[model samples]
Structures are given as structure tokens and as C-alpha cells.
Target: MSSKSINISEEAYERLNSWKKSNDESFTDVIIRVLPQKRNLSEILECLEPIDEETAEEMKKAIDDEDSA
Candidate 1:
């Protein structure tokens, strides 16, 4: 595999370094572990906080209006 050089802020480097599991762990490994994983619609919805009835109705209305366009 080939490696490329990139510059990051000192703060960013420090943040990534802090996530390293061990001295053997690479920056790439830390990044992959920290990044968000893809989820299905149901899985995504399950993660959301419950909204009030008014907010739910507003969201439904907005979605309906967009669909009708």
C-alpha cells in the first residue's frame, strides 16, 4: 500500500492521537473506529429522540407538502 502526506491542525492531530487504542494503532485505524457507520432507515429512526405531537405533525406536513410538489 502507498501512503500520502497531508497536513492537519495541531488540535486535530491531538484529537486523533487521543483516540488511539494503543501505540500500535495507526491514525487510519483510529479514524475508521471513530467514524459513523451506515444504518438502514429503521435503525436511523430508532436512534432519534421522541418529538412532541406538534413537532411530529409539523414534520409530517412538511413532508406531505414536499411530496405533493
Candidate 2:
């Protein structure tokens, strides 16, 4: 695999080095492996708080129009 040189602060480098699984693994690999996955809006929307009163009224009107179609 291809590789490139990178500059980092001593503290940051130490952090990544501490997380490294083995000498064969690179800091880049460690970062990618630890990265969090993105979440979909629909998955969390059900838990969403209600919109403000004025916006809620406008939202109701829009939703009603959509439903009448």
C-alpha cells in the first residue's frame, strides 16, 4: 500500500500511538477503524422535539395541503 509523511503534535501522535494495535498498523488505519458511522435522519426524527408554535401552524398547513392531494 502507498503511504505519505504527515506532521503532528507530540501529544496527538502519542494518543494515536497508544491506540495502535501493532507496529505493522499505521495511525491512519487506527483513525479509520475508530471513526463513528453516520446516522440517518429518519432513524432519529421520531425522537425529535416539536417545532415552535408559529412554525408548527405553518407545518400543519403544509402537511394538510399534502394530504388533500
Whole-model Cα lDDT of every candidate shown, in order? 0.94, 0.88
User: What is the Cα-based lDDT of residue 39 in candidate 1?
Assistant: 87
TM-score of model 1 vs. true structure? 0.50
Per-candidate clashes, comma-separated: 0, 0
What stretches of model 1 exceed 4 Å from their correct place? 37-69
Runs in model 2 lying further than 4 Å from the true structure: 1-6, 38-69
The ten-residue window of minimal lDDT in model 1 covers 29-38
Give a tens-digit lDDT track for model 2, residues 12-40: 88988999999999778898898755768
Q: Which candidate number maximizes TM-score?
A: 1
